[model samples]
Target: MIETVENRPQPKAAPLVVHVVRQFLPNRGGLEDVVANLARQTLKRGYRVRVVTLDSLFTTPDDKLPALETIDGIEVVRIPWTGSSRYPLAPQVFRHIGDADLIHVHAIDFFFDALAWSRLLHRKPMIVTTHGGFFHTKKFLAIKKVWFRTLTRLSAMAYRRVVCCSASDLNQFIQIVPDGIAIENGADIGKFADAASRRPERRIVTLGRFSVNKRLDHLLDAMTALAKRDAGWHLDILGAESDLDAADVRREIAVRSLEKSVSLMISPDNQTIRDVIAKASLFASASEYEGFGLVALEAMSAGLQPVLNSNEAYRVLAGRHEAIALADFTKPDAAADAIEDAYRKVATEGSALRESLMQAAHAYSWDAVAERYIDLYRSIEITI
Candidate 1:
């Protein structure tokens, strides 16, 4: 039983059609969540929304997805990329997205749709959401930097609007296009709330793909630091491991003898993740960089206090809001102290602070986020 918006405004003759382009759907990670949620929300608003995604041999048609069915009344069409490289796939993707009023591409860094839309399908109003530039290690950053430049240049020429998940992401694109819009990502607070209530214990949790950019090793280091001070503290690391460096993380955890204190799990479904967050006391992230900390927001929604690095993305997302506390992980003892402080703050403040955090979380609902995108879409001038 999928949720659909029954009462919605219609544009007289036919529903306003939109094609959402992405590399993958219903797989895992923040980008997948964003695409799925946006499609669902748009369908709720009565728009004829279809998700256009790259066909992966790994992802099957039977995969469970809210967007897979007409959740909120949106249609989804997953297209296969027949070509081997990005350049060859551009024509195929553009062909699939034919005749759509608006084409919204997410994670434009790795996808070929943006280049295709720019070079081939110039008639349609295209928008790109730059999730974030991958800032892994020095080598990864150097390689991605070139891609970033090329994408930005192509986007400036082809797309009507460039949207970023956070101010930090917008800053990265500003080098290419100065006026990109910042639309903060949203979370399903209700789902997270429901998940948290069912789980037991106040466990510390961190969520993300196990990649170098995620800086998960730092989290392990922080856990080691925290365990030395508070023997009762435990951590759960949950996410997919697609990179080779994940082997390194396993070795580090073993060497530190954190097998008991820390637990590692692969990516889980939204409800399963919520269940973990509900039982947890605090949510912690050690990423050196982030486009937007959606997991931290989910933890906060679940009434778990957030302890995150004092990076630009976290600061922008959680700073003005009092729901989360910041930690300067650059210091020797900052991570340990931050975690302790988060627990104490939640304990002392009681349900009042929790209520406020939940309220803040609602401000980032997908429905509200959809309105921002709609406004951006309407603002684009159709070229003859």
Candidate 2:
């Protein structure tokens, strides 16, 4: 005779999401910014958030920061980094991933294999968010050839979900992996939004890490041309020198004799950035590659007209906005012309343009993004 069996009920705890990235906190980048914002928003939605990252010895100096700590209501664990900065090794990463209810890994790197290993052994639901192209670049082609097999294996078997920050980014990622979901990055609109009417000061501002892709050289050429037409306007390029040396940028400024017309504010604090952007007449970016231009959105939200380089991603995001002036940044004359046009638009329709920019920014709220992520998490199957 068969015996009747009773079903047992299991207790559920608060959902814990562990976000793994190459670097976090103190080390600032577009990837780092997105993770921090999403983590905070996730916490607000009644979920516990934790960030696992490597201690960046190359990018940031050792400040004696604690290995394990909490930042903005999210628990953070920084494992010591070994090997070259281009390819860091973090053996301690395994210890952290097993405890997470759901795992979200970021970027395309050696550590991707670590996450993939954890996924296989722990049998946890995993998501991998590829910020953008890491393989297509000229510098990384050799490395890509060597690691292509491993990368493909991880993409195939590592994660349940694959996410990209932009539609353009998604298209690039899909060339390597068959499927991906586009989840655009967001800016802190409230922090950048200005309530008062904007009065432009004939000043332009741009912010981004110093890298070849940023094309600061091209921007300087455009500024030189702009200075020839109008000496009244000045440009401020504010940001950390990550990939490109600061000396090289200064040398370019000297060659163009744009010392007075252009200046570099290296690595200013967050408040200083807000203050500078708030007073700027125009905001600009000459970046040849952007996963998602969060800084451009921030500048727009702050009521500054944006003069952006022509690209599929920016063009898509700009969406025929009369406020965004697009130009081929490779050509100095073209870039200068676009900047002038954007400046005139701001001068003529300041309040109206500001309103339109705010409307665009409102559509990319972090709260909305958080809700989407929470829904994604709840839908995924996780073992208690």
lDDT of 2 by residue, 56-99 (tens): 53545455457887786678898887786666788888888776
Runs in model 2 deviating more than 4 A are 1-12, 61-64, 140-150, 195-197, 320-322, 382-384
User: lDDT of model 1 at residue 286?
Assistant: 78
TM-score of each: 0.83, 0.90
Each prediction's RMSD over C-alphas, in Å, is 4.2, 7.4
lDDT of candidates 1 onward, in order? 0.68, 0.77
In the predicted model 2, the residue pairs found to clash are: none
| Poorest 10 consecutive residues by lDDT, candidate 1 | 57-66
Q: Candidate 1 has which clashing residue pairs, if any?
A: 4-72, 196-278, 202-281, 203-280, 203-281
